[model samples]
Target: MTNRKPPLLILLGPTASGKTKLSVEIAKANRCEIISGDSMQVYRGMDVGTAKIKPEEMEGVPHHLLDIVDPDTPFSAADFQTIGKRLIDEIAARGKLPFIVGGTGLYIEALIYGYEFSEGGADPEFRKEQEAYFLEFGEQALHDRLREIDPASAERLHPRDSRRIIRALEVAHLTGVPLSEQLAKQTKESPYEVILIGLTLERNLLYKRIEERIDTMLANGLVEEVQILLDRGYSPSLVSMQGLGYKEIVPYLQGYSSYDEAVYLLKRNTRRFAKRQLSWFRHMKEIQWVDVTDSSNFSAHLSAINAIIAGKFA
Candidate 1:
């Protein structure tokens, strides 16, 4: 007979979409632990900008993967998949539910689909060549190159997305195959049955929440947080510093822009990021969308989630 166990429940959505609070409430009710799926939140000292859950906010529910790595260290989706799967197993072993929560679609997808990364070696020299090409010719130049070799991949990537552009080029150079084809060839079953719950709102309301969140972060010592990281010798070029709100303030700290200007730019960029996140989640066929515009009521949402979980586990 097949062993009967409960599936993982994933709470995912764009930034500033009320995920942390809702996830905490759900965990409290269901006797579950939350394993964060966010990429940035893994870095130590990245608190305010990442909107990390504070100790008081945890409300006695355990959260995993919030502050595990140094900001300068490399953390990939593959690494997240390995660590998250282990955490889920451990949580299950403790006789509790595992709830995954965050806005990072790639990380969530990696966990839910168990995507495998190729062990194909990357050439530092080749990577440098691509980086130089990106620096000199701009992201469009690299995106155009991807268009020629892998139209499918290029179509998926935004021309302004420098990191993914470089990654696509690196994958193509290392494997002698289009990055899209490499991804297409990889197939792995999910290690856990999962229920993906996607939180969303109307565009205007979402943007409003994002702007308000930025204000709250600023009022809550976001600049001080970045200052502390900088004081600790974390470079602006580090991955953690490159996160949404953190990166925009680097210029201000360096005297390139005023603090107010930096805040404005940060809010604008955050809104754009939220839009991209929504687009990504919209393409995910498995997600059960929850609209929070009218009510913003956690009780209502929790009731819906509890009913879904009960049905799945019953």
Candidate 2:
């Protein structure tokens, strides 16, 4: 750890793990401002789908990087790396703790590890050909091409994630460096003194939570929210529209899947996504896990976390 590095408090967990409320409580108590690490939350029109905290819900704790771009605009982990690190520095300079709170493992890792994208050998022509391939077939086809070249990254990415799939193929084609190798090749040094906190619940409990969260979203005008975005001229194929809650609801709104069917699929897929999130965090050894299942209350959990922070920053 760098002796002079600013403190970074991270609160991470799978979807519906109550990370947002817990993070807010901790941040409010500790004079910390949160920098969201979510990919979908950056889009301007996305709210319920991204599980975004409303302004009144923020409880006066400042947040960064939410509602940053339009649905059609492309944002990547590289963007998060740049913007997130800058917020960490800016927050610390203002004499407040910086809290990075989200379930996006790649975004968090990129910020913490200072990941360098070696674009030294990038070939725009080759990248254009890849983009043409994506347009001809689909983003899944693009990811399939990557699977042949870089299986490590392919496993981590969703099939519709064209931006990362293209970048991986570009790296392999130009420099013979797969995206996995580029990240793994770097020395494992975190720039900030991160007080990492990972929240978890029982598996069955978490699945139940996922189902209930979907139910709440539906009741709270999630379908209407998607309609508003479509009404605003965003296409269904836009990357932001393909987010978990947004994409599943599209079929229903387009006169395809019934509302019940869309709701069912959303719940099922979200459970699977939560499982993948836990898998991602499991591999990141730095996060100290706390089973909210075992805790009596959230206050107790925060108290325990404060002890951990004390040891790190004492």
Candidate 3:
């Protein structure tokens, strides 16, 4: 490890858990710039569904990695790590702190823990074969195949997570090794001296917040946003379109489902996603969790975090 300390702060939590607001506050206080950890927020014109921070809400805290990629372009975790690390270094070089904030656990972990991806190249032919297999045999058949190869990974991934499942299978087919084994072999010490601050709230309140956010998105022209993307020739099958709220509402836009049904499903899926995020972060032993159930007194949480940062950097 290098003797020089790298300044990086990570504020992470589930969706609708108030991470964005807290992160902005922390960044402004620390003279830091924010790098978003969200996978969807990287895509341009995905504002409403991704719940991207409005320009006014930023309060003059500069943010990087938001709206950088086109929706039709493929983005991967490895790509994010490469770009994120560069930005982190650039920020630190300027004598400012780097605040990484988002609810995407995989993206956050990739940046903090430093996962090494295989040097495997994408095989269009193999992807087509896997897509055909799913179309012919269904999702369960593919998941069962994954179970036979990597039971542990299969256990964690839901069957309906077609994207990851397909990627795993494609990797196995091309490399002749299970994807789990590849991930297992790849590890590195994080280059930064980092602090992980996780924000959470009561389950009931979090769910309520998610519902209200979905309602706000609908009212704020989320459907119109999706329609514009579609008009731009973006496929519904694209990875960007498959994001949480975006995918759920596509059918409604296509007249296959009622708007009410679409909103209900989006809220339900978002709640489930938040629960999964909480579970994932809970297992990371290094995190200092803040329960913001009573937002009336955020000072306690803020003070605790400041104390930790001072202890680490002093």
Say which candidate scores most in lDDT: 2
* TM-score for all models, in order of appearance: 0.91, 0.92, 0.91
Please, what are the lDDT tens digits per residue for candidate 2 over residues 138-228?
8788888999989888887777767667877888887777878787776568877878889988999999888988889888889999999
**lDDT tens string, model 3, 109-172?**
7887788776376898888888899889998998898899887568556566678888888778
Which scores greater on TM-score, model 2 or model 3?
A: 2
* Tens digit of per-residue lDDT, candidate 1, span 1-314: 88654478899998988889889888987889999989899998888889999999999999999899999888888889899889989998898889999998878887778777773667788778887988899868988988998886786665655666677788887778987677656653566778889887888988888899999999998888888888899988665687888888888888999998998899888887887788777767888988777654778887887777776754
**Candidate scoring better on lDDT of 1 and 2:** 2
Q: What's the residue-level lDDT of 65 in candidate 1?
A: 93
Highest TM-score against the true fold, candidate? 2
Each model's RMSD to truth, in Å? 2.4, 2.3, 2.4
Q: Tell how far residue 222 is off in model 3, in angstroms.
A: 1.4
Residue 133 deviation, candidate 1, in Å? 2.5
